[model samples]
Target chain A: MGRFVIRRLLQAIPVLLGTTFLIFAIVYALPGDPIQALAGERRVDPILAATLREQFHLNDPLIVRYGYYLRDIVSGNFGTTFRGLPVSTIFEGKFAVTLKLATTALLFEAVIGIGLGLWAALRRGRWEDKAILAFTLLLVSIPTLVSGFVLQLVLGVQLKTSLGIAFFPVAGVQDGIRSYLLPGFVLATVSIAYLTRLTRTSLMETLRADYVRTAVAKGMPRSRVLGRHALRNSLIPLVTYLGADLGALMGGAVITETIFNLPGIGQQLFTSVYLRENPVVVGIVTVLVLIYIVANLVVDLLYAVLDPRIRYE
Target chain B: MKNPSIDTHPPADEVAQEPLLVVDNLHVEFATRQGVVRAVNGVSYTVNAGESLAVLGESGSGKSVTAQAIMGILDMPPARIPKGEVRFRGTDVLQLSEQARGQIRGQRIAMIFQDALSALNPVFTVGWQIGEMFRVHRGMSRRDANNKAVELMDRVRIPAARQRVNDYPHQFSGGMRQRIMIAMAIALDPEVLIADEPTTALDVTVQAQIMDLLAELQRESNMGLILITHDLGVVADVADKIAVMYAGRIVEHALVHDIYKNPAHPYSKGLLDSIPRVDMKGQELYAIKGLPPNLLNMPPGCAFHPRCPYGRPNCVTDVPPLYEISGTRGSACHYYREVLDGTVQ
Candidate 1:
C-alpha cells in the first residue's frame, strides 16, 4: 500500500506540471496586452509603457516568461495582480468560500440523490419511481442558470410576495445555514438528478445479480440484502462517475456562482478575466486543476477500499 | 468409530407415507416482449422425508425453474407460476405471506446452487454469511452464531475451520466454496435440502467427494434431499427415486436401479444410452437427436415425440398421461410395454 501511494504521488507530479503549463500557455495566448489593458487609454508616453513592460518582464520571450512563471511559483512568489495585490490573498479568501459551497452542494446532492435513488430502485414500476423520474428529468433538462433564476423567483420572489416576507435569502451567503440553502440546493439539483439516475440504475442491476439471489436464499432480511449486499456493490460504478465529474463541476461552478451572486472563486475568476487580471486568474485556475487531480487520486485510492478485487499495485 | 444410532422417531415406513414437499401441476411462464413463453408446464412431483429424488433433465428443460419456484425466489413479472401448489409440511408455500414464507425458507428448506463461487458474496467472509442464516432465522447472537458457523464449517470438513472462518469466499477453492454453500444450507438443519447440480461445476474427484458428503449429511439428518442435475452418473449412488423430465414434463419416474436397468420411456432409454461407459469402449456414444421443443409453440401432443426415435403417428396426435407400468414405476407413453419388450424397435 505504501509503495502504491508513493507511485500515485509520483504520477501526480507530471499531471500537475502538464495542466499548469497548458493553463499558462492558454492565458498568455489570449488577445490584448495585459499591461496596455491595465494602463487604459490615458495620454501616456510610449517610453513609460515600455518601462512598465520591462518592469513586468513582458519584454521576455514566451519560454522565458514561462520559466519565470515556474520559478516564481517555486519560490512562493505567486506574483502581484495587475492591481498590485498579492495573488495568494485573493485566491485564499475566495477559494475558502468556493470550497464551502462546493462541499455543501456535494454533500446535499449525494445524500438526497442516493436516498432517492435507493427508494426509487426498490419501488421500481411504482408511482414513487415515476414521480422521482419525472422530477429528476425536469431538473436535469433545465440549464443551471435557468434553475438558479427560477428557484430565486419562486422561493425568493413568490414567497416574499405571497407571505409578505422572505423565507429564503435572494442571494449571497449569510444568515448561517439558511443563507446557503437556496444557492447550494440550486447547484445540487442537477447533480442530484444525474447521481440519482446513476445510483438507481446501478442498484437495480446489482440487485438482479446471482449473489443477491444467494443472499436472499440465505434468508437475509430484505433490508440487509438491499443495503449491505446490493448497495455496496452497486456503488462502484457510481463512485467512478462521481470522481470523473468533480473537475467538470468545479469548471461549471463559474456559471452557477454568477447566476446566484455567490462570492466564490468562480465569481472572482470571472471578474478577474473581465478586468484582464493575469495573476489571480492564472493562480486560481492552477489551484482548481490541482484540486481536480487530487480528487481523482483520492478516488483511485478509495476504489481499493470499496472493492476487494482491486489490488493497490 | 462406534455405530451411530439411527433416528427412530419418524418411523421409516410412516415417513415414506407422508410427503415432505408436494409440487402440484406447476405451470411457470415468462412474459417476454414477443409473447408468453411457458417454461414449466404442468410439472408435478413429490418428495418424501429421508428420500433423495433426482429431477433429471438437460439444460433449458425448466429443472432450475421448478426449484426456484419452490423456493419462492422467482421474479413475478417475468416468471409467473400460473397454476401450482408448493406444499411444504402440509402448508401451501406459494399462498403463504412473504413474511411467513421467509420464516420457512432457511429454517425449513434450503438450496445450494450450481455455481458455488457466484452464489457466495465476494465482499463478506463465508462464515459471516453462513452465520447470517442462524442470526436471521433463529435470532442467535453474533458470538453464538459464529461458534455454530465454525461448527458447520468443520462439519462440512473445511480445513482449519477456526482460522478459515474469517476468510472471504474468494479465499477458498471451488470445491471448498461448495462445501461452504453446503455448510450454509445445513446450518439451520432444514427438513428439505434442494441441491441444484451441486457437483456439476466441480471435477470428477471433487464431485465424488461432494456427493459423498451430501449423502453422509442426509443420512445423519434424515432430511429430504432433492438433487437436480443432468448427469445420471452423479445420481447413481445418491438418488433413491429418479424423475426424468423432458421439455417441462416428467416422462418417467421410478426407482433409481429400476430406471437405470430398464428405462420404460424412449427418452429415458436414449438418455441412458447417451452416457459414455467404461464397458462401451470404442463404440460411438449415443446422442439425442434435435433440441428440446420450444415451449412457446410445442408440438400438439407429446413434447418428446419429435425427438423420440420410436415415435409413432399416434404419438403426435395423442398426449399420453403418466400411467403406472408397475407397482413402483410410471411412464408417460402409450407404447411403454412395446418399447420395453423391443417390439417397437
Candidate 2:
C-alpha cells in the first residue's frame, strides 16, 4: 500500500505540471498587456514601463516565463500579485472560506442525496419514489446561478423580513455556519440530483444482487441485509463520485461565491482574471490541480478498503 | 472442535413421522408485463432427516423457485405464493410471520446457490460472510463467530482455512468459492439444507468433489438435503429419491434407482435416455426434442407433450395427474404402463 501510494503521488507530478502549464499559457495568450492594463488610461513614462516589464519578466517569451514560474514554484515561491501581495498570503483566508463552503455542499450532497436515494430505492415504484425522482429532476433542470440568487432573495431576505426573524443572513459568512447553508445547498443542487440518481440506481441494483438474496437466505433480518450487504456494496461508486466532486465543487464555486457575496477563492479567481493577475490565477489553479490529484488518489486507496478485489500492486 | 455450546433446541430426530421439511402444493407465480408466469404449480415433496432428494428439471422448471419460496426469499412484488404450505417438522413456515420465518431461515433451514461468486458478498471476507450466520442468529461475539467460521470452513474442507479466512470470494476458485457458500449455509447446523443447482457452475471433477463433501456433511449432521439440479449423472450416487419436474409441476417422482431403471413418465424416460453411454459408442446422442414451455404461455394440457416421443392426441388436450405407480412412486402420464413396459415407440 505504501509503495502504491508513492507510485500514485509520483504519477501526480506530470498531471500537476500539465495543468499548471495549460492555465499559465491560457493567461499569457489572453488579449491585453497586464503592465499597460495596470497603468490603465494613464500615459506612463517609457523608462518606468520598461522597468516594470523587465522586473515582472513580462518581456520574455511564454515558455521562458513559464520556466521561471515553475522554478519559483519548485523553490516554494507562488509569486506575488501586481499589487505586490504574496499570492500565498492572499490565498490564506480565501482558501479556508472556499474549503468550508465546499465541505458544506459535500455534506449536503452525501446526507440528503444518499438518504433520499435509499428511501426511494427501498420504496421503488411507489408515490414517494416518484416524488423523489421528480424533485431530483427539478433540481437538475435548474442551473446553480438562478437557484443561488432566487434562494438568496427568498430564504435570505424575503423570509427573514416577513417572519421578522434574523433566520438567514443575505450574503457573506457573518452568521458563521448558518450563512453557508443556503448558498451551500444552492451550490449542491445539481450534484445532489446526480448523486441521488446514482445512489438510487446503485442501491437498487445492489439490493437485487445475488449476495443480498444469500444474506436473506442466511436468515439475516431485512435491515442487516440492506444495511450491511447492499449498502456497503453500493457505496463504492457513490464514494468515487463524491471524491471527484469535492475538487469540482471548490473550482465551480465561482457563480455561487459571486451570488452570495462570499469572500472565497472563487471570487478571488474571478477578480484576479479580470485584473489580469496572472500569478494569482496560476497559483490558485495549480493548487486546485494538486487537490484534484490528491482527491483521486484518496478515492483509489479507499477502493481497496471498500472492496478487497481491488488490491493495488 | 470449536462448537460453542449452542442452545439445544428440540431435536428434529424426535419427529420421525413428520419429515424434516415438507413443501406441499406450493404455487408461485410472477406478475410480469406479459402475464403472470406460473413458475411453481402444485409442487409437493418431502425431505426426511439424513435423506437426500434430488429435484431434476431443465431450466425454468420451477425447482429453484420452489426452493426460494421455502426459504422465504422470493421478492413479493414480482413473485407471489398464491397458495402453498412449507411445513418444517409440522409447523407451516409459510403461514408464520416474517420474523418467525427469519428465525427458521438459516437457523433451521439453510440454502446454497449455484453461482458461488455471485452468491457470496464481494465486499466481505469468506469468514465474515460465513460467521454472519452465528453473529446475527445466535448473537455470538465477533471473535466467537469468526472462530466458528474457521471451524465451518475446515469442515467444508477448504485448504488452509486459517490463512484464507480473510480472503474475498473472488480470490477463491469456483469449487473453493462454492465450499465457502456451503460452509456459510451449514454454519448454523440447519436441519434442512437446500442446495439449488449447487454444482451447475463447477467443473466436472470439482462437481463430484463438492457433491461428495455435501453428502459427507449431511451424513454427519443427519440433515435433510434437497439437491436441485438438471444433471441426471450428478444425482445417481448421492440421491435416495428423485422428483422430476416439467413446466412448474412434478411429472414423476420415485426412488432414484427405480426411475433410472424404468421411467414411467415419458419425459423422465427421455431424460434418462439422453444421458450418453460408452456402451452405445457410435449411436447418435439422444436429445429431448423442442424447448421447455414458456411459463407465461403454457400449453393447454401436458406441458411436455410437445417434446415427448410418446405424445398422443389425447396428451395435447388432457393434463395427466400424478398416478400412484406403487408404494414409493408416482408418474404424471396417462400412458405410464406403456412407457414402463417399453411398448411405446
Candidate 3:
C-alpha cells in the first residue's frame, strides 16, 4: 500500500507539471497584458513598464516564462500578484473555506444520497421510490446556478420571512459548521441526485444478485442480508462515483463558492480569471488538480478495503 | 470438531426420526403479465434423515422451484404457493410465519447452490460468509465466528484452510469455491441440505469430487440431502432414490437401482437411455425428441406424451395417474406395464 501510494504520488508529478504548463500557456495567451492591465488606464513610463515586465519574466519567450513559473511553483514560490500580495497567502485563507464547504457538501451527499438511495431501492416500485425518483429527477434537471439562487431565496430570505427566525446559518455564524450548511447543501444538490441514482441502481442490481439470495438462504435476517451482503457489494460503484465526484468537486466549487460568497480557491480563481492574473490562476488550478489526483489515489486504495477480490500488486 | 451444538435445542434429533422433509402436493405458480405460469404443480416427495433424494429432470421441470418452495426462498407476487405443505418433521413450514421459517432454514435445513462464483458474495472472504452463518444464528462474536469459519473450511477439506480462511471466493478454483459454499451450508450442521444443481457448473472430475464430498458430509451428519439435478449420470450413485419430473409433476419415483434397471415410466426410460454409454461408442447419442412444455402454454393432456415413444391417442387425451409399480415405486405413464415388464425394450 505504501509503495502504491508512492507510485501514485510520483505519477501526479508529471500530471501536475503538464496541467501547470497547459494552464500557464492558456493564461499567457489571453488577450490582455497583465502589467499594462495593472497600470489601470493611468499613464506610466515605458521604463517602468519594461522593468515590471522583466521583473515578472513577462518580457521573455512564453516557454522561458513557463519554465520560470514551473520552477518557482516547484520551489513553493507562487510569485507575488501585481498588487504585491503573495498568491500563496491569498490561496491559503481561501483554500480552507472551500475545503470546509466541499467536505461538508460531500458529507451531506454521502449521508442523504446513500440513505435515500438504499431506502428507495428497498422500496423499489413503490410510492416512496417513485417520490424519490421524481424528486431526484427534478433536482438533476434544475441548473446548479438556478438551484443555488432558488435555495438562497427560499432558505435564506423566505425562511426568515415566513418563520420569523434567522434561518440562514451564515447570518450569525462565520466559517463554522452551521455557516457551511446552506452553501454546502446547495453544493450537494446535484451530487445528491447523482449519488442517489448511482446508489439506487447499484443497490437494485446488487439486491438481485445471487449472493444476496444465498445470504437469504443462509436464513440471515432480511435486514442483515440487505445491509451486510447487498449494501456492501453495491457500495463499490457508489464509492467510485463518490471519489470521482469529490475530485471534480474540488474545482467545481466555483459557482457554489460564488453564490455563497465564500472566499475559496474557486471564487478566487473565478475573480482572477477576469483580471487575467496568471500566477494566482495557475497556482489555484495546480492545487485543485493535485487535490483531484490525491482523491483518486485514496479511492483506489479504498477499493481494496471495500472489496477483497481487488488486490493491488 | 466444531459441531455448532445442534443439540442446543433438544428434540431436534428426535424430531428428525419421523422424516426430515415431506412436500405434499406443492403447487407454485408465477403470476406474470400474460397469465399464471405453473412452475411446480402438485409435486409430493419425502426425504428421510441420512438419505439422499435426487429430483432429476430436464430444465424447467420444477425440481429447483420445488426446492425453493420448501426452503421458503421463492419470491412472492411473481411466485405464489396456492396449495402446499412443506412439513419439516411434523410442522408445516408454509404455515409458519416468516421468522419461524427463517430459524428453520440455515439453522435446521441449509442449502448450497450451483455457480459458486455467483452464489458467494464477492466482497466477503469465504470464512466471513461461513462465519456469518454462525454469527447471525448463534450470535457468536466476530473472533469466535471467524475461528469457527476456519474450522468449517478445514472440515470441508480446503487445503491450508487456516491461511485461506481470509481468501475471497474469486481466489479459489471452481471446486474449491463449491467447497466453500458447502462449508457455509453445513456450518450449522443442518438436518437437511438441498443442493440445487450443485455440480452442474463443475467439470466431470470436479463434479465427481463435489458429489463425493457431499456424500461424505451427509454420512458424517446423517443429514437428509436433496440433490437436485438434470444429469442422470451425475446422481446415479449419490442418490439413493431418484424422482424423475416431467413438466411440473413427478413422472416416476423409484430406488436408483430399480429405476436404472427397469424404469417404470416411458419418460424415465427415455432419460436413462439418453445417458451415453462407453460400450456404445460411435453410436448416435440419444436425446429426448421434443422440447419441455412451456408452463404458460402447456399441452392439454400428459405433458410428455408428445415426446414418449409409447405414446398413443389415449395418452394424448389423458393425464395418467401415478401407477403403483411396487411398494417402493410409482410411474405416471398409462403404458407402465410394457415399460416395466421388459416388453417395450
Candidate 4:
C-alpha cells in the first residue's frame, strides 16, 4: 500500500511540471512592462526602468526566468508579488477560506445529493422519483454562473431596493455563517446535481444486481439490504467522483467566488493573472495540481476499504 | 459424503407428516408494458422435511419464479400473486404479516440461487456474507457470527476456510462460491431450502461437487430441498420426486423413478429424449421441436401442445386438469394413461 501511494506520487510529478509550464507561459506572455505596472501612475525615467529590468533579470531568456521560479518553488519559496509581498504568505489566509468553503459545500452536496438519489432509486418510476429526477436535470442544465447570479438577486438582494428584506447576505466573507452560506449553497447545488445523477444511476443499477437479490432472499431487512448491501456497493463510483471534484472545487469555482466577492485563491488567481503577478499564479496552480493528485490517492485507498477484492499492490 | 447417517423414516410415517412447504394453486403474474405475463399459473406442489423435490423446466418455464415466490423475494409492482396460498406447516403464509413471513422466509426456509458468483456480494468477504445471515436473523455478535461463518465454510468443505473466510466472492471458484451461498442459506438450519438451478453456472465436475455438498447438507439437516433446474441429469439421482413444468404449470408430478421409467407427459418425454446419451453414439440427439409458448400471448388451451408429440385436437381447445395416476402421482395430460402404457410414442 505504501509503495502504491509512493508510485502514484512519483507519477504525478510530470503532471505538476506540465501545469507549471502552462502557468509560467501565461504569466510570461502578458503585454505590460513589469516596472511600469509596479510604478502605477509615477512617471519613471526610461533609464530607471531599464536599470530595474536588468536588476529583475527581465532581459534574460524566458527559460532562465522560469528556471529561477522553478528553483524557488522546489525550495518552498513562492517568490513575491510586484510589491514584493511573499506569495506563500498571501496564499495562506485564502487557503483556509477556500478549504472551509469546499469542505462545507462537499458535506452539504453529498448529504443532499446521495440522500435524494437513494430516495429516488427506492421509489423508482413513481411521481416523486420523476419529480426529483426532473429537478436534478434542471439543476444540471443551468450553468453555475447563471444560478449563482440568480441566487444573489433573490436571496442575497435586500428587497428594500424593490420589496424589503434580504434572506441571505449577498457577498463578501463576513462573520460566521453569513460568510460562506450563499456562495457555498450555489457551489454545492451544481455538485449536488452531478452527484444526484451519478448516484441515482449507480444505485439503480446496483439494486438490480444479483447480490442485492441474494441479500433480499437472505431475508435481510429492507433497511440493511439497501444500506449495507446496496448503497455500500453503489458508493464506489460516487466516492471516485467526489475525490476528483473536491480538488477542483477547492481550487475554486471562479465564477462563484468572483460574483460573491470572496477572496479565495481562485478569485486571487483570476485577479493576479491580469495584474501579471506570475509567481502567485504559478504557485496557486502548482498547489491545486498537487491537491488533486493527493485527493485521487485518498480515493484509491477508500476503494480498498469499501471493496475487499481491490488490493493496492 | 461426510454427513452423519440420515435418520431413516418409515414410508407410512413420512406420508402422514405435514409438508414443510405447500404451494397450492399459486398464481404469479408479472405486469409489463406489453401485457400481463402469466409467469406461474396454478402451480401447486409440496415439499416435506428430509425430501427433495426437483422442479424441472427449460428457460422461461417459470421454475425460478416459483422458487422466488416461495422465498418471498419476488419484486412487487411487476410481480403479483393474486390467488393461491403458500402454506407452511398448515399456516397460510400469504396471510402472514411481513415480519411473520420474514420469520420463515430465511430462518425456517432459506434459498440458494444460481449464478453464485453474482449472488454473493462482491464488496463483502464471503465470510461476512455468511456471517450476515447469522447476524441479521439470529442477532449474533459480530465476532460470534464471524466464528460461525468460518465453521459454516469448513462445513461446506471450503479448503483452508480460516484463511479463505476473509476472501471476497470474486476470489473463489464458481463451485466454492456456491458453497458459500449454501453455507449462508443453511446457517440457521432452515427446515426448507429452495435451490434455483444451483449448479447451472458450474462446470460438470463442479456441478457434481456442489450437488454432493448440497446432498450432504440436506441429509444432515433433513431439510426440505426444492431443487429447480432444467438439467434432468443433475437431479435424477438426488431428487426423490420430480415436477416437470410446461409453460407455467406442472405437467407431470411423479416419483423420480416412475417419471424416468414411464414419463406421463409428452413434454417430460421430450425433455428426457433430448439428453445426449453416450450409448446412443453417432445418432442425432433428439430435441423438443418448438419453443415454449409465449407467456404474454399463450396458446388457446394447453401451453405445451405446440411441441408435444402426443398432443391431440382437444389439447388445443381445453386445458387438461391434473389426472390422478396413482395415490402418489398425477399428470396434467388428456391421455397420460396412453403415454404411460407406451401406446403414444
Predicted structure with the largest DockQ when compared to the true one: 2
Q: Return the TM-score for each candidate structure.
A: 0.91, 0.95, 0.92, 0.90
Query: Which DockQ-derived CAPRI band holds candidate 1?
Result: medium
CA-lDDT, candidates in order: 0.85, 0.91, 0.86, 0.85
Write candidate 1's Cα lDDT for B232-313 as tens digits: 9999999999999988888899999999988999999999999999999999899999999988888988899999899889
Question: What is the docking quality class of candidate 3?
Answer: medium
**Each candidate's fnat:** 0.56, 0.96, 0.92, 0.87
Q: Per-residue lDDT for A1-313 in model 2, tens only?
A: 6776687779888988888899899988999878877888887789988998898999899899999999999998999988789999989889889989999999999999999999999989999999999999999999998898899999888897888777788898889999899889999999999999999999999998999999999989888998899999999999999999999999999999999989999999999898989899999988888888889999988976898787732
The runs of at least 3 residues in candidate 1 whose Cα sits more than 4 Å from the true structure, single-residue gaps closed, are A1-11, A40-77, A311-313, B1-16, B278-284
In angstroms, the error of model 3 at B284 is 2.7
- Ordered by DockQ, highest first, the candidates read 2, 4, 3, 1
lDDT of 4 by residue, B1-345 (tens): 111122222245543675777899999999999999999999999998899999999999899988888888888879999898777666677666777777777788899989999888888888889998888888899999999999999999999999988888888898889999999999999989999999999999999989988888899999999999999999987999999998899999999999999899888998899999999999999999988888999998788888788888999999999998897799999988898888975
Q: What is the DockQ of each candidate?
A: 0.66, 0.85, 0.74, 0.75
Candidate 4 scores an iRMS of 1.0
lDDT of 2 by residue, B1-345 (tens): 112123124355546667778888999999999999999999999999999999999999999999999999999979999897877877777777787777889888999999999999999999899888888888899999999999988999999999999888898999999999999999878999999999999999999999999999999999999999999999999999999999999999999999999999988988999999999999999999899998989997888888888889999999899999998899999999999999987
Once fitted onto the true fold, the runs of candidate 4 whose alpha carbons sit more than 4 angstroms away are: A22-68, A81-85, A159-167, B1-17
- Is model 4 an incorrect, acceptable, medium or high docking prediction? medium
